[model samples]
Target chain A: MMTLELYNYWVVIFLMMAGFYMLIASNHLIRKIIGLNIFQTSVFMLYISLGKVAGGTAPIAAEGIDTYSNPLPHVLILTAIVVGISTTSLALALVIRIKESYDTVNEDEILEIDRIADEEGSSA
Target chain B: MINEHLPALQVVVPLLAAPICFMIFNNRLSWLFATLVSWLSFAMAILLVMEVRDGTVLHYEFGGWAPPWGIEYKVDILNSYVLLIVTAIAAAVFPYSWKSIQKEIPKSHHRIYLTAMLLCLAGLLGMTITGDAFNLFVLLEISSLSSYTLISLGRDRRALTASFQYLIMGTIGATFILIGIGLLYALTGTLNMADLASRIPALEGSRTLQAAFAFLILGFGLKLAMFPLHLWLPNAYAYAPSAVSAFIGATATKVAIYALLRFLYTIFGSSFSFDYMQVQWLLMPLAIASILFASMVAIFQDGIKRLLAYSSVAQIGYILLGISLVNVTGLTASLLHMFNHALMKGGLFLALGAIAYRVGSTQVKSIAGIGQAMPYTMAAFVVGALSLIGVPLTVGFISKWYLILATLEKGYWPLTVLIIISSLMAVVYTWRIIETAYFQERPAGAAPVTEAPMSLLIPTWIVIFANLYFGINSSLSTDLASRAAIILSGGSLL
Candidate 1:
């Protein structure tokens, strides 16, 4: 009943959790970035869906238009979208550098490598 | 003509100059330009503080469209103090980086470092100055992104992983904040924080506001590295370039704390957050845990930067502890510690950077007999350590005095004992480094290190001197902190 009544919110929550789960569960750094993207996208959708007004058209002045979906949330989402894209790109760039240095992108492998490095650094 | 636009220019000048700084391409020129820009912003922050000294709020409407319609840049005593901290750190760190980054970062990346520094400064100032909620998010990301870049500039490969982890955590935190702001907007149909402040009172017991408040605090908790969410911080601060460690150690988290204060006090109102929501109950426990937990961890850290990084978490706990007390004195202590932390942490990290410059490493073992090697830098480190321990006639002592006073006023005797115990923990951690550097003999075959260059020493001392000066003569800091605290508590400063 809840899902059917508030389907859009359910969709957002579901996507958010899945993305969050993947972000924590993934071993690959790139996958983590992908998960982060999915997570961000869900938030964007939440804003966009909530801005919609029933029976409303685009928020532009017209002779017949009495109601219009709020344009402000859409504007806000646009900015958020830009932020998301930049985060993704920057994260991927970090992963690339990480892969170059550590010779692997698997989280455990990189961590192991760093551990080894720390051990060697201390012992030397 | 310029007075009205000062608030906007406070952020705009550095933001616009960041790209141009990168274009300069020459190393020293880039450093000089960035330093000049930081000083300019610092001066503007000082000016803003002076203007708001009488407790008047300066509102700058973007394009003259007014609040609720266009973006607004608002300056009050609370945020002006934050702006001063952010810009003052940037001013000092930029000059210090002139020499430090040359040694720590590659020549090719020098321009990028300066550019990122300016961008981060602009972002922190913008987040503090803006009256709009969404604008704060945008600016927060701007600062967060640049800081990630800054952290990754360290010569060590571990810096890459540290920066990567920070980016992931920071992005998640920011997205949570965005979702919270969207919820607030959905509830109130506006994004202006001042407007939201007015409308929020009418929506009492609204579950949506409750949800918004929950998301906002959780996100800010992560951003401010409140206790358990602090995993990303120590490594991020530890592996970053020395100048970066100093710059971020001083200002980044302090600004985040300021943002939290704004949301907790101004937008939500202390009554709503404290009385109705009982947020202090939640915050107080976390603050206590961070102090004891992080201080304990600091004692075990082998790396000096990592030690201080853990201590930063403990210091953050002190600020939050003050906040959780829910009175003007507690709030005053929080603001005072924010300023004092900037001075001490900035100086300590700069001193550590100097040690790293000479010793080529900052491991506790690596710095054996370092006091004799680099007398001035070690002396500066000792002073910073003393301040960190809340020794008498230090900034840390003054803030802790106020915090203890605040707790006592609330009949929290146990909390006083806990504060003293935590300060003892600080003593233990700092004593480890001092004993290693001064008391121990230099291992055989070790090269004799000279004192850090005058350039590094001077900037380091600037903050060190400020830390000592502000500690002895606390009138200025106390006045600003109390006035800011009063405003935050919904009281008229006048």
Candidate 2:
């Protein structure tokens, strides 16, 4: 039982690490947003998994129910999901603007442009 | 009836006004409405502070649900004091934004700008006042989202990248906080902070609880721009619109620091956080490194706003250093520095806004001879700079004095010396700007510049004068801060 419970957390940790690695490693702005979505979704899943109980039904008032899964984490994650969506949309909007202005969505290329601009700015 | 709802109204007023601001498409009307809402919130904050000054904790339950079940708005001296600073800075910044935004932001984006500003204010106030752990995460996101919008509204193209960087980091921080809160809820079976605090003590040895604490610190450390995790701040500040630079510089991280304090001292309890976890050992070195490292970085920055942004990181170090001391005086210094730094940095940024208003640039070299052209604005900057350096008879000195005393009380003389050395580094950076502005001749063929409009000057000077006034007569701040600190440290000021 302990090994199984530990395995559940291990999956959560694996998803978390994978998501974070993508977020940090990706240079493409759109990919970074995707990475952020995955990162946040993994956290949401973690919360939901924590609420799971063996041999439990949905949390609801009923005439006969011996065990019920906790609904609080579900409720919390629902709100977090909304926040996550909003953040992703806003991030995409920023990427759109960044692409328009810098004419590139690659973080490295954008940094190079900014660096050149900075050099010219100081020299001027 | 209204008095009973002050806690809710403090956040609700700005939250509601944000959508209303969006509806008012006319730039002037939208700005007027935003300013009025900010002032109203500021007034409410003052009343709340006065009510809680005697160590009263105002607990307002939402939807008539008792705490540990229903969400609660908890306003004590600690939060009320922070609320006052946040709203006061908003109140001052909004009035100044009318003119500053006119120049920095496009006319078409003005309404959206005002709306985002109001939303950010509401979200910050909500974050500070909420007692539920989950509610704090929601409010944190609200403010974080709006601030990203505000930062991206800057005229420079780099603002886009800056805003995106901040969004990524802020969302990660918020997620970490959410995970921590979720873990705590699983442990305690309650979302309310007071409930958690009561239950946390019994589960002290649990690894999950310990992990939650670590996550909370790491998350809030990112949010507060603590040391090595502060990569997103300087660009965000330097590229953001001038008014935004002032407003967020003055309030956002300050609120994050308040959140850290609330979690560490109030929820986790000082004993668990400091004694069991040894958070001081973890935080102290980071704090010292930030103070030394960020200040050195500031000394080389060409852009004045970027310089001040790095300075803010160093100042945050001082606040955190106070916390790591884990004593009454240290905590008091931290609390006091939060208020004082708001005044000093707010005034400095607003002064920079005025210069940017006239010269259309914030580069140190570009502002040569601004002392002659924009005397009032430059004077304000000089006074703020002095305070930043922690000179005597300024608000900065009071905080540093308490900090040094706190270190002495702990027999940490070397730490005290480090604090003084950081102040000297501040002086060096500040002098670079002063020398460029006052001594260097205005570049040949440069257009003649005038003093910033009275609208900007008045707010800027009000903040600067407050710095001086509070420095000399610090009883009000010290009294409230000491009492709050005592509460946090589980001691009595008396």
Candidate 3:
């Protein structure tokens, strides 16, 4: 039982690291958003996993139900999921604007353009 | 009856006003509504500070549910003081935004701009006042999202990239905070901050709890723009619309600092955070580095807004240094600096907005001889700059005086010298602007310019004058800050 309990945490940790790495390593803006989504999803999973109880039913406060999984984490994650969706949509909108202005979604390319522009600005 | 509901109304007024502002298509009407709601919130904040000034804590449970079940709005001396600063700055910024936003942001986006500003204001106030851990995260997202929108409203194309960078970094920070809160909840089975405070001490030896502490600090450090985690701040401040810059520079990071204080002292308890974890060991060095490095960087920036943005980062260092000291005078200094920095930075940014309004740019060279044209605005800028440099008879001076006294109390003489030396660096950077504005010859063939209109100039001067007024008469600010610090540090005044 203890090993199984820890296993869920281990998976959550692995997914979290993978997503964080992708968020940092990717230069493409949309890919970074995907990385953020994955990262947030792992956190959601962690919250849900924390709420689990053996032989527990849904948290409906029904008659004769002595054991129930925690409902609070579920509610918290529900709010978090909404927040995550908003963040993804906003990020995509920003990426669209960046693409329109800089003609690229890659971070390095955008920085290069900005560097050239700053030089021109200072010189002029 | 209304006084009892002040805590809830303080946030709800602005939160509800945001959607109403969104519904109103007219830009001027939306601006007026935001201004009205901000003033209303400020009035509510004042009443709250009065109510809680006698070392009383006001805890309001939502929908009449008790703690650990219902969300709580807890206002003590600490948070009420922060509430006053955040709402007061919003009130000042809204009226100032009218002309500044009109020039810097497109007309079509003006309604959206006001809505985002109000939402950002609401979220910040909510974050400061809430005692529920998860509610704080949700409010953090609200402010961060709206602010990203507000920053991208700047006419300059770089604003887009700046907002994107901030969104990425801020989302990571928020997620880290969520992970930390989840860990705490899993361990303690409670989300009410007061209840968590009581519970966290028993679980102090657990590795999971330790990791939660680390995550919370890192999360808020990023949000507070602590030293190395501050890469996203300067660009965001420099590229955001002038009004957005003023509002966020004054309030957003300050509220984050409030959150840091709340968690470290209120929830985790000062003994565990300061003595056991020895957070000062990590925070003090980073604070020193931020002060020295950011001040040096500020000296080299050509854009006035970027220069001030870097200066804002350095000022955050001063506040962090105060917190690291972990004593009554030190925490008092940190709290006082929060209020003082808001005034000086808010005024400085508003002055820059005025310059941007007439001169069409805030580049150092572009504003050459602006002193001769916009005398009042530049004068306000000069007063704000003097305060930034910690000159006597200014709010900056009071903060540095207490900070120096705090270092001395800790028997850290070298840090006292370092504080003085950094203020000298501030002198150099601020003098650069003064010289360029007043002494440098206006370039030939430049369009004739005049002082910024009364609408813009008045709000800028209000903050500038407040800096001087509070500096000369320190009783009000010092009294509240010291009481709050005593509560936070659990130490008596020396």
RMSD to truth, every model: 0.9, 1.0, 1.2
How would you encode candidate 1's per-residue C-alpha lDDT over B100-161 as one tens digit per residue? 98789999999999899999988999999999999999999999999999999998999999
Against the true structure, candidate 3 reaches a TM-score of: 0.99
What lDDT does candidate 3 reach at residue B188? 94
Off by over 4 Å in 3: A1-5, A61-64, B491-494
TM-score of chain B of 2: 0.99
lDDT of each: 0.93, 0.94, 0.94
Candidate 3 clashes: the total is: 0
Q: How close is candidate 2 to the true structure, as a TM-score?
A: 0.99
Q: TM-score for all predictions?
A: 0.99, 0.99, 0.99
lDDT of 3 by residue, A93-123 (tens): 9999999989999999999999999899878
Per-prediction DockQ comes to 0.89, 0.92, 0.89
User: Where in model 2 is the C-alpha error above 4 Å?
Assistant: A5-7
What lDDT score goes with residue B160 in model 2?
Answer: 93
Instruction: State which candidate has the highest DockQ.
Output: 2
Q: Give the per-residue Cα lDDT of candidate 1 at B489.
A: 92
Error of 3 at B206 (Å): 0.8
Which CAPRI level is candidate 3? high
| DockQ for candidate 2 | 0.92
Q: For residues B213-320, could you state the per-residue lDDT of candidate 2 as single tens digits?
A: 999999999999998999999999999999999999999999999999999999999989999999999889999999999999999999999999999999999999
